[model samples]
Each structure stands twice: as structure tokens, then as C-alpha cells.
Target: MKLKMSIVDAFADKLFKGNQAAVIVLERWLDEKLMQDIAAENNLSETAFLVKEKNDIFNIRWFSPLCEIDFCGHATLASAFILFKENEALTSIKFYAKAVGNFEVYKKDDGLIQMNFPKREPVKVQEFPNELLEGLSIKPKEIYKNVQAYFAVYEKEEDVLNIEYKSELLKKLAPYDVVVTSASKNREYDFVSRYFWPASGGKEDPVTGSIHAGLTPFWANKLNKNILVALQASKRTGVLFCELKEDRVLISGKAVQYLEGNISV
Candidate 1:
């Protein structure tokens, strides 16, 4: 079968800046193994497969090169980008995921896509795992853990940038990734962060929107503010506008189309 595939750079105004997610719009659900193979073939951080459920609703799933994940923010934005571009009349779209539940994406007047995601507020963990500390070259001032990943709080943005990960050790922290972050030195941004998921996705993620769901609330409480700007300090960087609500986090960014073609499977 021939399937339509598009690569979109999410959280970036231009191509090759943000995380690239491969999005495929499917009319029906394909076999799980086939979808996994497709995602592995794409070899991106995340590949999104979606099937339209209604006029404005879609059921979506995300997969990394290694396995299917419960949630992925960039791929969802990329999918919304494709849907918006295809139908100008569409101002918003609702996406349902099996484990993550429902999320809504709206097109702003400024051309940014705003995603309403559940707040994943992390709590301080009293005991720091030895493997987690051993996996990183730098020691964190504080550490927090949630369902998804570990949050490593650093003293400065420079520390976050200078981190060298021991991928082998990180692999020991399977099923959970690590996020190292600190207050941004740059005046334009409120905080800076880098994500590492050697055990799950890759050694490093260019720009991650899903983690920001937890990061936003964590920083907001620490900084004593509700709205903030975050910059992911990966080689291919990206910026995100985050707002912390009572039970949800609003992540907003722009996505640009990188490639579009047909995939034969």
C-alpha cells in the first residue's frame, strides 16, 4: 500500500531547527507490527499515525525507533500542522491517544499551534538513584520524578549545556528518560533544558514538547509565575511558550513542513 507521509519540524519556524516528526494519515488502523516497522524505517525520534474519527477528531499513536510510546508532543503538533495546511477552514483539532487521553490543538492568529496537554507535575524524590547520578557527568542540585522521566535541576544553564551523558548508565534507567534543566542565562528565555532518553528514544532529543508539560509547572512554581518561555539547548534547538493552568499546561509553538511524499509499504 502507498501511504502519504510528511515530515514536519515542530516547535520551529523554519526547517531543521526543531524536532522532526514523521506524520502519516491513515484511513484505517494498520497492524501494530507494521506501524512499528514503519516508525523504525522513518528512524526519527517519533512517528505519528492518525486515523480520522470524526470531522474534527482523530485517533493518533506515536512510536519511536525502538517502541511505541504513550505520548509525544512534537508529532502531535506535526499532525496538526498537516491537518491545518490541508484544510484552511480547520481552526482546531482534537486528538485522542490510548493512554494519554484527549488533547486539543488550536491554530492561533499568529500562526502558532497551541496544545492543551495534561499537567505532569513532578514531585521531589528523597532518594536519588545511584545509576541516575552515575549516568551523568554533572551532579544535580535537586531531583524529581514522575511517571514519564526524571527531572534533574541544575544551578545554571551552562551546567545544563556542559552535561555529558553516560549512555550505558542511562540505559539502566529504562522506561524513564532524564531532563536536565536550569534557569536560562539568556534574558529572552525563562529556562533552558535538555532531554536524554538513551534507553527509550535516543541519547538526546532536539526539542521535546511532552516533557515541558511537567517542566512548565515545575518552573512556574519555582519562578512564581504562570507564563514562561523555555528553550531546549540541543544542537537543533527549539523554543516553547508555556502556560501553567490549574490542571493543564498549554504549550504553543510553530511547525514548518519539511518534506512530503508517498511511502510504499
Candidate 2:
């Protein structure tokens, strides 16, 4: 069998700067194992498989090499990029993930794709796990947790940049990952973050738009502003424009296509 696929550099203005996601729009859902095998074969952080449900609504699922993911921002944005590229008149699309309910994505006049995700505001955690403490070179000043991962708040942007991860110790956190973040020194961005998910997709995510749902609200309250800009401090860094809407966060970024081809199974 043959299938069409696209590799997109999401959250990037230009090629090779952002996280890469493999997107496959299918006529029907493939077997669960097939999808997982495909993700492993593609070897990207996340491979998004989309099946059209209606006029502009589609069922989307993401898989990593190791396992399936509940939520994935970059891959979703990549899927939207494929859809919009196919139909330029399309201004908006709704995606339904089995794990996370329906969410909307829009193509703005400015050419960025905006996603509306639930506000995943994390609560401060008074206790710390030994694994978390031992995994990093520099410890965070405070820690918080939500459904996705543990949020580690640092005092300076330098701390965020300098911290090193002991993947062995960090992956012990399993099921949950870690986020290290601090206010950016750069005048252009509001906050900066680095994602470490030894338990999930990869060692580091080049740009993470999903985590910004939690980060946006955290920084918004910290800086006393609803609108903020973020920089993912990974080696191949990327920028995200964020807004803390009422019960949701609006995350926007640009995606560029890296490659297109056919996959045979």
C-alpha cells in the first residue's frame, strides 16, 4: 500500500529551525500497530495521522517512536499546514483527538497558524522527587505539575540554558516529562523554555507549542500581561506567540515544509 506524507518544520519561519513532524492524511484510520510502526520508521518526534471527518473537521492522532502521545502541538500545526496548503481558501479547521477533545486551529491574516488549547495551569508542588533533583545539573527554585509534565521554574535564563540532563535519571519520571523555564533576557521574547522528555518523544524538543499552554498562563500571571512571546532555547530554537485567553491559550507559529514523498507499506 502507498500513502502520502509530508515533513514540516513547525514553529519555524524558515527551514531546519523548528521541530519536524511527519504528517499523513489518511482516508481511514490505520491499524494501531501500523501507525506506531510508521512513527518509528519516520523517526520524527511526532508523526501526525489525520483522517477527515467532515468539511473542515478531522480526527488526528500522534505517535512517537516509543508510544502514542496525548497531545502534540507541532504535529498538529504541521497537519494544519498540509490542509491549508491544499485549500488556500480554508481559514480554519477543527481537530478531534481521542485523548484531548475538539480543538480549533486558524490561519490568521499574518500567516501564522493559531491553536486554541485548554489552559493547563499547573499548581505549585511543595515536594520534589529524588529523580528530578538528581537528573539536572542545576536545580530549579520551584516546581509545579499538571497532567503533562513537571514544570521547573528557574531564577535566570542562564540557569535554563546551562542545565544538563541525566537522561537515565530523568526518564525515570516516566509517563511525565520535565520543563525548565525562565524569563527571557532577550527584549524580543517574554519567556524562554527547554523541554526534556526522555520518557516520551526525544531527549529535547526543538520547539514545543503544547507546553506553552502551561507556560503561557504561568508567565502571563508572572509578568502581569495576557499576551506574551516565548523562545524555546533548544539548539535549533523556535519562537512562539502566545496569549492567555479566558479558559484557553492561543498559540501561534509558522511552519515550513521540509520534504514531501510517498510511503509504502
Candidate 3:
């Protein structure tokens, strides 16, 4: 089969300086093995597939080079961007997926894509395991747990930016990924964060949107505000505008379509 794919740099105001995600629009869902193979071959942080159906809704899935993820923000932006560019009639896209259960993407008049995702509420833990601590280097000021993985929060943003985890060790402890975040008290933004998923087939993700689902609510309660602006402090940093509503997070970002072509298998 031939797959038409596009490489998009999301949350980038300019080209080549944002998180890159491969967006593929498919007629229907492919076999599980084939999807993994394609993701491995692409070797991107995340590759998103969108399958359009009879109704206005579409089915979406995200895979990293190593494994399929429950949810991903940057790739969702990429997929929405592709749909907007390719189908003028599709002014807005609603995506239903198996990963995070279900999410929707809508196109904005200002040319940005917005995603509504589940909020992963994190509660404080007594202490983080030494194995997990070894990877992050910084002793977390606070730790949180949810359904998938653990989250560690630092006292300061500088520490968040300076974190250097031992990738090999972190991979062993984290079930899916480890997120380290800090309140950006010194900066204009509300928070700064990073994601390390060495266990799930990567060292450090350039920018992560999914992790923010946990962060948004955590900071929202701390800051006593439901809205926040976040910056993912990866080498190629990305910005996310977030809103913490009841059980969902509204994530907004810009996407730049860089390349489009077909992959033959």
C-alpha cells in the first residue's frame, strides 16, 4: 500500500524550529504490525494517522518510533494542519481514537489548530523511587501518579531546563514516560516542562503535548487559574496555550507543513 504523508513542524512560528510530526491520512485503519513498522521506518517522535469515515468524525492514532502512544499533541496539530490544507471543506476536524479514548481537533480562523483532550489529574506522592530519581537528577519537590506514568515537579524553572536524566536507567523505571515540570515564576509563561520517554523508544522528546494534560491541571490548581501558557523546553522548543476545563484540556498551537509525499511499503 502507498501512504501519503506530510511532515509538519508544530508550535513553530517559523519553519524547521519546532517539534516535527509525520501526518498520514489513510482510507482506513491498517493492521497493527504495519502501523508499527511504518512508525519505526519513519523514526519520528510521533507519526499520526487519520482515517476519514462516513460521518464527519475521523479516527486518529499516534505512534512513536518505538511504540503506540495513548495520546500526542504535536501530531494532532500536524494532522489537523494537513486536513485544513488538503480539504478546504474540512474547516474543522473531530478525531476519535483508541489511545486517549476520544479527542477532537478544530481549525481556527487565525490559522491555528485546537485540540480538546482529557485532563490527567496528578496527585502528590510521598517520594519518587531512586531508579526514577537517577534518571532525572533533580530530586523532585513533588511527585504525582495517574493511570499511565509518574510525574515529577521541580521547585524552579531553571532546574526544569537544566535536567539531564540518565536515559538508560529512566527507561527501566518509567512505565511509559517521565515528565519533569516547574512553575515558570521567573518567566512570562506559566510553566516550562520536558518529557523523557527513553523506555518507550526515545530519549527526550523535543516537545510533548500529551504530558501537559497532567501539567495543566496541576499548575491550574497551584496558580488558581484554569488557563495557562506552557513552553516545552526541548532543544527545539514548542509553545502550547492550554485551558483546564472540568475534565478536559484545551491545547492550541500553530503548525507549519514542511513536506508532503508518499511512502511505499
Candidate 4:
């Protein structure tokens, strides 16, 4: 079967600046293993597959090279970007992820795609994992946990930037990943962060929008701001404009399309 595929750099102003996600929208859902194989072939962090359930509404799923993800923000942004570009009349789109429930994505006047996601505020972990302490070069003072990842709080942005990781050590903490973050030194942005998910097949994600659901609430409470700007301090850096509302987090970023073609499945 011939399927359409496109690669988009999400949370990026230009190509090669943000995390890349493979997007495929179809009339029906493909077999689970086939989708996984396709994602593995793509070799990106996340590949998003969708089927239009109704007008401006689609059922979506995300997969990493190794396994399916519970929630993925960048790929969702890419999906919205593709759908918006495909039809100019679509001002907004709603997605239903069986794993994480439903959310909405809409285009703003500034050309940024804004996603409304659940606010996942991580609480302090009572028992810290030994692997977390050994996996990083710098030990964080406190750690927190939410639905997806463990939050490692740092004192300085440089700590988050310069810290090295042992994949094997972090891999031991399976079922949950890690995000190291700190208040940004650059006054232009409120906070800085880096995502590492050795267990789920990604290492140093370029820009993770899903993790920001937790990160935004964490930082917003700490920094005492409802709205903030975030910088993902990876080699291919990207920025996120964030806002925290009642029980929700609004994350907006720009996505640039890099490649489009057809693939046989």
C-alpha cells in the first residue's frame, strides 16, 4: 500500500532547529505492528498517525522507534501543521488519543500552533531512585514525578546544559523518562530544559512539547508566572511559549515542514 508521509520540525522557526516528527494521516488505522515498524523505519523520536473521525477532528496515536507513547506534543503539533496547511478553512482541530484522552490545537494569528493540554503537575518523589543519582554527572537537589517523566530540578541553566548522562544508568529507570530543567539565565525566557529518554528509544530529545505539560506547571508555580517562555537547551534548540490556565497548559510553537513523499507499506 502507498501511504503519504511528511517530516516536520516542530517547535522550530526553521528547519533542523527543533524535534522532527513523521506524520501520516489516513482514512483508517493501520495495524499496530505495522505502525511501529513504520515509525522504526522513520527513526525519529515520534511518528504520529491519524484518522479523521469527523470534520476537523481526528483520532491520533504516537509511536517511538521502540514503543508507543502515552502523550506526544511535538508530533501533535506537526499533525496540526499538516492538517492546517492541507485545508485553509480549518481554524482548529481536535485530537483523541486513546492513551491520554482528547486535546485541541489551533492556529494563532502569529502563525504559531497552540496546543491545549492537561496540566500535569509533578509532585515530589518520596523515594528517589538510585539510578537517577548515578545516571547524571550533577545531582539535583529535588526530584518530582508525574504521569510521564521524572523532573530533576537544577540550580543553574548551565547545570542542565553541561550535565552528561549514562544511557545504561538511565535505562534502568524504565516506564518513566527524565527531564532536567532550571530557571533560565537569559531574561528573555523563563526556564530552560532538556529531555532524555534512553528507555523509550530517544536520547536528548531536541524539543519535547509533551513534557512541557508537566514542566510548565512546575516552573509556573516556582517562578510565580502564569505565562512563560521556555528554551529547550539541546544541540538543535527550540523555544516554547507557554501559559498555565485552570487545569490546563497552553503550549505554542512553530513547525517547519522539511520533507514530504510517499512510502509503501
**How far is 117's C-alpha from truth in model 4 (Å)?**
0.3
Cα RMSD (angstroms) for every candidate in the order listed: 0.8, 0.8, 1.5, 0.9
TM-score of 3: 0.95
**Candidate 1 C-alpha lDDT tens digits along 1-265:** 8999999999999878999999999999999999999999999999999999866579999999999988899999999999999999999999999877888999999988999999999999999999899999999999998888999999888999999999899888888899999999788999999999988888899999999999999999999999999999999999999999899999999999999999999
Q: Which residue pairs come into collision in candidate 3?
A: none
Candidate 2: segments with Cα more than 4 A from true spot = none
Model 1: residues >4 Å from true position, as ranges? Answer: none
lDDT of candidate 4 over 28-140, digit per residue (tens)? 98999999999999999999999988665799999999999989999999999999999999889998987667889999999999999999999999788999989999999
| Model 4 residue 232 CA deviation in Å | 0.7
Query: Residue 63 deviation, candidate 3, in Å?
Result: 1.2
TM-score preference between candidates 1 and 3, better one:
1
TM-scores, each model vs. reference: 0.98, 0.98, 0.95, 0.98
Candidate 3 per-residue lDDT over residues 1-265, each given as its tens digit: 6788899999887887668999988888899889999999989899988888788678888998988887788888888888888888776777888768667788878877889999888887786677787777778888887765678888888998998899888878757578888889755699998888887859888888788888899899999999899998899998889999899999999988889999998
Evaluated at residue 213, the lDDT of candidate 2 is 90
Per-candidate clashes come to 0, 0, 0, 0
Q: Which pairs of residues collide in candidate 4? A: none
Clashes in candidate 4: how many?
A: 0
Q: State model 3's lDDT.
A: 0.85
